[model samples]
Target chain A: MSEIFVKDRELVMPGDVLAKSIDILPGNGTYRDGEEIISKVIGLVKLKERFISVIPLSGKYIPKPGDRVIGVIEDVQPTFWNVNINSPYLGLLLLGEAVREYVDVTKTDISKYYDIGEIIYAKVLHVSRSGVVSLSMNDPKAKKLRGGKLVRITPYKVPRVIGREGSMIELIKEKTNCNIIVGQNGVIWIKGMNEGLATRAILLIEKESHITGLTQKVSKLLEEGDKK
Target chain B: MKKGKPERLIIDGKRLDGRDLEEFREMEAKIKVIKSADGSAMFRFGNTIAIAAVYGPRPMFPKHLQNPERAVINLRYNMVPFSTEDRVRPGVSRRSIEISKILKEAIAETVFTEEFPRTVIDIYIEMIQADGTTRCAALNAASLALADAGVPMKDLIAACSAGKVDGHIVLDVNGKEDNYGEVDMPVAMIPRENKVVLLQMDGLLTKEEFEKCLQLAKKGCMQVYKLQKECIKNTYKQIAEGDENV
Candidate 1:
């Protein structure tokens, strides 16, 4: 008989046997040992249709090719900008990819577009084997962020803050009536009226991310705020 | 006048602290104690307290040291000046260097370094209080911090110390017992795997007595393992309960 050793959302320690039987496969945060799959980190066990994976509670951001991220320009070079993507590896943003229009490199200074310590939203272009991260601002959504409160949470909690298919975030925006951008790297940019409420909601989500039925609780909190 | 060692360490099968031969000191552990680090924990074994912080699985600096095939593990074990009565120096000592190397080697056994090639894992252990068996306490704290940092590992490692004090096999020797004990052995292992990653000895013991001490140490480690698992679980449990502050 196919058996699952752990239930959904149950906390598991390293070396814990999460599942058994040859039909079951191990996914992220889990590894296969013989016929049994084991958890390799302290996390919650999530059971999919045919595979079991553990979702880690805390970790540094690991850049993937398709991830959208927020970064601060650390240095401006002739051809590229060295950006701090809040990871150990520095992200490179090429000048040619920064804007859709062409500029004379000799005449126009690159600092006008991206100065040091300025924050911007960009997409990960490529992550090399050597840990070099290439970022691109060529996407229409990518642009400079200004006059907004930026908060960082655990990168793993970004998914929870976003909720299911933008439902939770949409609720926060509607409740607070604010513009909020949640980055894949866990950096959030908030602006407009009631930015504090949006920040507080994001903080609540990050703090209570392990809880089940979190969406309902957040909805209740937002409804209460509507009265006041 | 020189202080003489105590003659009797065990009374009625209980050690000086009223603990049985196989009993461990009161222990407490908590994860995410430090907000700045990638992962951090505070562990206390009796009066001995150690806080460990873990950083990386990130990029390695000093270009030449980066490993293309696996991540590098670096450990630093240091005792604060006020941790002991004598007020030790602030910098690393010869003793600290040796402990750091051993702790690194033991923790490296459990970490899956190949998963993040060219990255580095740095573990820092600071002894806030020193009674006895500080290295063992530090090892326990470091393992918890590593797991808290979400490092891929084979298992969580637990460590304990056992020694022959006044001809009796005792678990978790205190500062006084360590000064008077005839043999001291500290051991660390992966409880689930039943694999020993660290075993070091100072002083002498007969063959039969050594075996007995090792068995007692393993039992002590198992007890510590329970606490370590609970510590990690509690951190997540609080979050699950919708607690705003964990």
Candidate 2:
């Protein structure tokens, strides 16, 4: 007999058995243990057709392929640059992936292009099973990010901050008159007239991401800031 | 100076603290007690208190120590200077080192280390008050902290102690009971799986008595597990209800 232990959107802790049947497929943050499927992290349960998974509330960022990330240059290697993408693993950006025009490495120093401590917006090209992340700046949207203040929130809350079809962030950008680029890794780059206000709004979103009607609350906050 | 042993730890079907042999100490647990830590928790069992904080699954320091197949656990167990009747030394002691290793092994069994390879998960547990079952309290706190950190785990580990007090096998021995008791044994297990990860005995026990003590300790651990589940659920409940104070 197949049995489901929890309802959709229910909060579950690690080791909590979610279902007992082979008919159901385990998703992210969940695993099959013999006859039962068990939760692997503390998060809200999500059920999709025959699949079930848990969305974690808090944890460090883990790199995945095709994720847009904002990273800081940690080291300037001769051929590749080591970028700290706010994750445990350092992202490697090879000379070929970063630059469109080839300059002889013997004649020109690679550091001149992306020096240490500089920030850049890039896409994850590949991630090895052992957690080695390779980055590429070949996309049209990818470029050096300068003259902006960075704000970090919990990585899991990144989707809430971005909202459905970028609605929440679009509202913040319009009201604060700021240019905001939100990275999938919870790093947000805000630049323009109201950087401070935008930062506060984004942080407020981070703190109350689980709450409903967050968009109304954030807009009210931004409006109040404009008055001040 | 050694204090004289009590004539009897249990009398008239009750122990010194006026509880039955199977009764466990009053327990309290809370999560997210430390803002700076990735995940943190505090646990209390009667007079004994322990707090644990977790950091990482981040890059392991000192390149050579990195494990390519799974994350490594680094645990530290410490008792504060004022935690006991007499002030304990401020640094790591031989006893603390052994306890830390024991606890790390117990907790490592639950965490899914392969999910984040080449990283390290550091757990720091501090004893705020000392009583018998201090290591058990530390284990409980560390387990809660790891779960709170969003570390993928098979199950939470709950620990409790059982001992012979005046020839009676009792669950959850206290400080005075430990001093006068003929035997002391602490047990830690994954309650859901019914798997024992750590067990230590400090004194002699007959085969039947040891079997009885193990059952009593597991029963006590189940009670602790219920408390852990309640506390974790309550924290998230407050968040779901939009209670900002949490």
Candidate 3:
């Protein structure tokens, strides 16, 4: 039997390291001092700064207090919209949450607030214990997008598109000169770019969303275009 | 799966629409189709493509998890971020977890735990695309996974959903029907015993509506059970036949 030691001194989950490297595949929490393949994300852990944890992708979405999201309107009533937050709990966008204004009840038209198929930019306001969520877009920061084009990728790919602390997206913006906002719900909004660059950027994000070493991959791919 | 927004109407004795109160969309399933999983299956209920796979009845190491009574069943229910028109995230969401839990419970009900007490059964289900009635498709797919694993069960658990849309109870509501429909009910049943193992409904439903939906969902489950059995026998038969020649 072969055994390895954990040299990074970082504790990780079994699934995560298994996904990245296999020196530990037939093993766990074990690492070799040298010749051990470096791991990307450690699934989920309870370690401090010295160690990392990995969270395997599951199909449930629980709205956090301050996460940026993109969602689609599943239905609309006279004063509210039912949003499929892509979570187990459906999201609700009240009439007042859609804009920054006070309207007389006599002149209010709920349909005018949000259409059934429209996409809305939002932030999670409150998640209730009874399995309901309140969403808000009225804050100055929550812009009601009408001019940007939206594209979607898998939710698991968000970390990739955003890159480590927004580095990946920043690189794309710098290279293509495009203003892009990626939603936690897997929606990407692109503005102020030609169709070619925008398409290229979207494809790049989509292709490398779940993969590690994506930044270099994008750079290499884009560099090929320059040479051609 | 049916389409379009559900609208409440009282036209004739008919359901504002022409569908009988008990009609179901086309349901079909296929198994051992995907090359990726150790064991895989695909189930289509109308436009929905629900896939399931079985992996690792192997040891869940750590030298700490080998139970003597039953194997741990780690279930995952995933809606491909593209399962609908809107792209979804490829990771776990709360709803996915809930679905996975329900699936695990449902399969646990029928599986003989003592048979493989030290092993772990991992059943994974992915909703490839949702037209409507995914719960039922998911049940069918999960059953196929258990079968693919060659795990013995008292019976294959079958599931289906029935709901009231536009004031009419329709069997196996499609995606459009679910969004706009007033009531959505999902049920998992064991046909051999005519027993209901899992039942849930969302939206509004009167007592009578709930009863009607329950009966309809059970009926749908039985029909699905037949298909599930056939799918299993056929898949194994095919595999055995192929191995024989090889």
Per DockQ, the best of the predicted structures is 2
Q: What is the TM-score of chain B alone in each candidate?
A: 0.96, 0.96, 0.87
Higher-scoring candidate on TM-score, 2 or 3: 2
CA lDDT, every prediction? Answer: 0.88, 0.91, 0.65
Q: Write the per-residue lDDT of candidate 3 for residues A42-158, one digit (tens) a residue.
A: 222223333323332212244666777878888977677898766545688887877668766567767677777777779988876544578989665676566667776545557
Q: Each prediction's Cα RMSD?
A: 2.2, 1.8, 19.9
Pitting candidate 2 against candidate 3, the one with the higher DockQ is 2
Q: Which stretches of candidate 1 lie over 4 Å from their true place?
A: A103-108, A223-228, B1-4, B242-245
> On residues B74-184, what C-alpha lDDT tens digit does candidate 3 reach at each position?
888888877787678789888888888887888788766554445567788888888777867887887776655445455667898888877777787777667776888
Lowest summed lDDT across 10 adjacent residues in model 1 chain A is found at A219-228
Clashes of each: 0, 0, 29
Query: Model 2: per-residue lDDT, tens digit, A145-192?
Result: 988889988898899999999999999999999999989988999999
A-chain TM-score, model 3: 0.68
Quote the positional error of residue B102 for candidate 3 in Å. Answer: 1.0
Winner by lDDT between candidate 3 and candidate 2: 2
lDDT of 3 at A185: 65
- Candidate 2 residue runs with Cα over 4 Å from true position: B1-7, B241-245
Tell me the lDDT of candidate 2.
0.91
For residues A54-160, write the lDDT of model 1, one tens digit per residue: 99877778889989998889999987899988775789998877867888888988999899999999999999987789999988788899988888988889999
